[model samples]
Target: MTLGEGTHTIIAVAMGVDGQEFPSAPVTFSVRLALPAPQITQPEAGSVQDMNLWIGGTGADYSAQVQLLEDFNHDDYGYSLVTLTGGWGRLFNLAPGVHSIVARQTINGRQGPVGIAHFFKVRPSRLTTVNVEILPSQEVKFSGTGHNGATVVLTYVSGPNNKPLPEVVVANGVWQISAPDWENGIYTYSAIQKVSDNAGGWIPSQDFQFSFPVSTKVPDPTNVRASADYSPIFSGNGVTGATVLIRKQDGTEAAPPAVVVNSFWSSQSRQEWGPTFDQIVQVKQRLDGQESEPGVGVVVRIAPLPPVISSLSDNELSPLIAGTCWSGAVVNLVFSDNPAVHTAAISGTEWQFRRRTEFAPGVPHTVSVTQTAAQQTSAPATRTFEIRRTLLKPVIIDPANGGEAERDLRVRGDRSVAGARMQLRVDGIDTGPATLTNGGLWYIELKGLAFGRRILDAQQTLDGRPSERSDPVVVNVVLMPPQFTTPQPGGDLPRTSTISGTGMPGARVDVWLEGRDDFLLRGYPVDSNGRWSSLVILPVGVKTLQARQAIEQVVSRDSPPLTFNVVPAAPYIETPVKDGHIGGSAVVSGFGVPGDTVSIYLGDTLLGGAPVLEDRTWSVPVTLTQPDGAHVLVAVASLDGFKSDRSAQQPVVLGRYEPSIDSPRAGSWVSHPVTFSGQGRLGTGQLVSWFNPELPWAPNLAVSAQGWHGLSVRALPAGGNWCRFQQTIVDGADASTISDWSESARFEVLDPASR
Candidate 1:
């Protein structure tokens, strides 16, 4: 039985089966089956108008899915699914005149018998590529024959991740999508037509993927980290020529570690290892490149070293025999920190580092961490890690001051640097400088300067980013006084504690103290902001900020101290601060020093002075005598005699006065002689007038002019006075022109009997 659009009960077993009647009280069918819904995502004929297929009757799917297939190449590949909405599916973009037949739909993990197949020819989609362009908004565009009404999808491919993002709709096959969200990273994107195949399938074009990562744009670089493994090494400061195997990423000898891969042309060899201990190894890639992200990554590996051994001088417990050459037996390797093993079986084994070395004449084999240092990570450490036995003496690195006496400056170092910090002191006083990262770029931000040479020093510790000053590195810095043009600056610019004056081609400028960082870009061009082409964020409040410059690199010089003053941003109320408004009084609080003046207002009227006390509190007495309506109350505060910014408006409701007309009620005609009166807040002196609903406004008539029977009235709280009114109408003239004429008592011919 077919049911209407409403709900209907479906029975697997009939209400009564084979002459056996089932209980009508509660009906339950034991038969379980599913019917698949037909999917006509693809059109059947080349240009079938009203086409439909019965992929499902009652025996198919009990809400099952039907999947159909459409193969452009006719290779017999049809997929299965179940879902059909909208009208019958029709094939699009059909060849001008070619007959094709689709049959045998796949459903519910099974193939069904071929239903009636239809043959038809399809003209190629009228959609011709009129034009494809990149929009100013960066969205790819597509236009063509029928493209005007076609659904288009834009896709982009990224090279760095080797994946493509989901397609986006640039427009409804019309204008352009101004802002494209596809730019999560550097990628190349293009638009394509998302049309249906004539049969029951979807067809995609073999168009070329957009060239990505957009050649002009670079993706977030891939971080590559490379390190070396050694059995034993020297003081790291003495070892001469050393050999390090370059380990690559893909178990090859080319991929290096700690590399920022951003471009397609940036292919590298996977080599594991480099030189060690006072030896130099070229990075093989661009030397001064930056990583995309702030974090470090291991993208490449160096070949495992053949294993070298050191610390032979410390083996005092043993002596050499009359004749013997030692292999790797006496001295063993210990690599618990940054460990490495040739194989999983060799992992954490003593043989990997085992060695045989003699102390001198006669002795027993020895192993001691006391005479040996743990692995040493030295400067220019591309992929090779420092592996020496250890002592408590940590490795210290310095910028240019030999790791000593410095002021208002930063020191750089590497290895075990994460969670590490440096401390700085300017001049002779300790001026807390900027903190540095594990990558070894320390900062000493300085503020407040006196022009001249200043000193800065730094110290560091792990786990905590701070400095107490162990190594004092000297740097010449200065605080240059700020200068501005004569025009009244519309906005207050930041107050910098630096003074800068560039000289001709041959001038020596000396900078010292905490302000030295500003001079780092002396040799380079500068931006309009007066910032050096290579300027970096400098530490604030650094001491001993000074700089000196001369006419030449070695001759007459000028030196001065750096003074900086950054104008703090003005603070305003983020949210309206309101207080209890009782008896027309409210207290407001602001974020500023106390003893400031504030203004209070009710509606648009200013009340009076509301000064903040030492506690930053300002209160004012405000009586809201306003009409019956919502009102906005405003309060403002000022600092240092500067013009104050108004606080957010506070919403409030003014008390309402209920008024009523008491006498000669409404609907009274103008011809009536009725008394008019009302109760209101208006005083006895307030003016009152009579009015009619027919007039645009109540007339301002005098007591004598209103009407002979009506009187001019005033509002009163207790009783009545000229508080009543009465009126009469004259037919011949307009009601407005007829003044209160008591003398004209004739609608007759001078006598009542004359009619």
Candidate 2:
């Protein structure tokens, strides 16, 4: 059907079989002229361009719009309205790809058919060269030359992923992009140049792959140190295979370059620099044609100077050897005649060393000293001096001529130098060295001295020279003091006590009382086996006694003072009369000296004690633990820390009145009435009772002097029955005492049928 280019309306009706017609609702529509397909004239078929280009076509209605399609998928790239003057239309920015384009036009809402497809391509941009550089500041920069006015798009390809990088526009055929924060590693990148189309849109090129290695910078030298010597050595740590350079603070080379091996580097200065002055230097490292910044300056110190010796006086013994040296230096001193060396650390600029061993008397001795600092030693300085010969003989102050000393004797003397060595001569034999006190007195302990008359002397040595022996002093090495076997310390003693002890035979012992010059017993005899005895009368008071032993005219030192109390008569225990019976708690009474305490004893065990009153009478309560047997007891009196000997023995007996059945032992079979017998305390009354599951009254059984007997029990039960007994003691007008019930004795009555 032919239609004009304008809106029009029409309607239709339905006709039935009987020739009757019904009109339908009116429908609206528009009629417009059909437009012809557009033709592309700008880009010929199969033609190629480096960037997107504008495409135009003719033969479309002037009022129609042209739509551009691209690629095999027929995607609409763009659309444009036809111009009224020439009936032509254009589309812009066709992307870079081998493409086929078909154009269609719509005139007054009526669409035309698609035109024939046109084949063309927008070629990818081109790049001639690409390079990657790592700046000194560790920034990564990518640069290349490509088509003019083209944008260089870079994508960092890491593993299987791609990251878009910032684009750079090419100017004068060159382009560059910087990644200032990129880490140090090998990196791969794919780049493409994007050129602008005629409509000012970008067209991407094919990917170009490239790789670059971003290396870490070389590290500066660390721990730079220099030794203080005539030829100093510099050392530090750096990267392996790198070169370390050292320069003075003034920028002049201080040492030749040294290559680092195993992260360590060392360089020695070629020229000799004396130890008189200090120097400062800097260090740097270079690796792979790259240099690192210099490190902090290091100072090299000067060597120490030789130690100086102070003036020395002649004839001085144990001289003070002092000198001056550099600060922080160690001063070493070596003696010419001695093989030992001594050293002293410097304090500030001064050093001192004292001579401990005395120098040879009356002979010149030389000593040399040197100072060392910072591993450098100086030359030696020397001094010479002599010690004086001034040793005096020592005189024996103790153990006078003809005096005696026992074993382990202490010998003392005087007239010796404070620090001089002293020795004793015993009967012409030299003993070991003695200890000298600060007051110029010397003493030595001599053990195991023989018992004989011995001559004693002493000698003094100073500055390695010994003086002649002092005037001879005769001494008698006698027996030690007698030890007392009786009357131990802090024990009681009576008048007319005999003091006996052991001592060397043939030696006589003399006993003396404290605060008295005269001996109480003199010339007491000592028997064989080193035994001695002395019978002396002591006063009635506290006494301290001492004894000494003597052979011929020499006497030993007095024995350790023995202290004891001289007590009077012993105490007497009167109560619990001799051989009397005791049970449970009992009273023990005794007679003692007034103001004394009496302690009672059973055998060796202490029962209890009581203080004596003004009447000289004492009583104490004692519990008896002895089982029904006879025991002995005694009483001792103590007064003023002195105890008297135990008094005469008093015998007693302990007993319990509990009764027991002896006849018809437990678990026995018997007839109707049971007979029982038992033992208990004499003179006590016992009661027997029986129970066959029921308690029954029984009669009291008398306990005579020989114990009780003949107690009978009667029961009719043909089964088990038991009986028990208890005791009581009744003494004139005293309350009765009852004992606990004894264990039950069970027995069975015989049944006639069963028997």
Candidate 1 Cα RMSD (Å): 36.4
Clashes of each: 159, 0
Candidate 2 per-residue lDDT over residues 1-755, each given as its tens digit: 67676776667788999999988887777775456678877677767654535577787766678888764677877777676553554325544556778888876666788888887768665454578876544466789787776688887776333435798888997888876656566777778887654555656776676777766666677778987666788998777788888899899999899998887889888988876445778888888888887465788775665778875543346777777887777789888778787987568988877776777554557888988776777889988776654566778888888776765578888877656778788889987755554435778888667778888888877657788888898887766778888788978776656777887677788888899999887888788667876666776578898888887776777899998878755777767866555666789986766777888999999999989887567899998765545678899877666677889998775544456767567888876555666776544444444543224424567776566765354444677866666665543222324444565577776885686
Q: Give the TM-scores of the predictions, in the order they appear.
A: 0.19, 0.26
**Candidate 2 stretches greater than 4 Å from native:** 1-392, 400-410, 414-456, 460-466, 471-491, 494-505, 510-524, 527-563, 567-584, 587-598, 601-635, 638-642, 645-755
What C-alpha lDDT, on a 0 to 100 scale, does residue 495 get in candidate 1?
21
Residue 521, model 1: lDDT of 31
Q: lDDT for model 2, please.
A: 0.72
Clashes of 2: 0
Candidate 1: tens digits of C-alpha lDDT, residues 90-123? 1223323334444443344555544344454332
Name the top lDDT candidate: 2
Shift in Å, residue 402, candidate 1 = 11
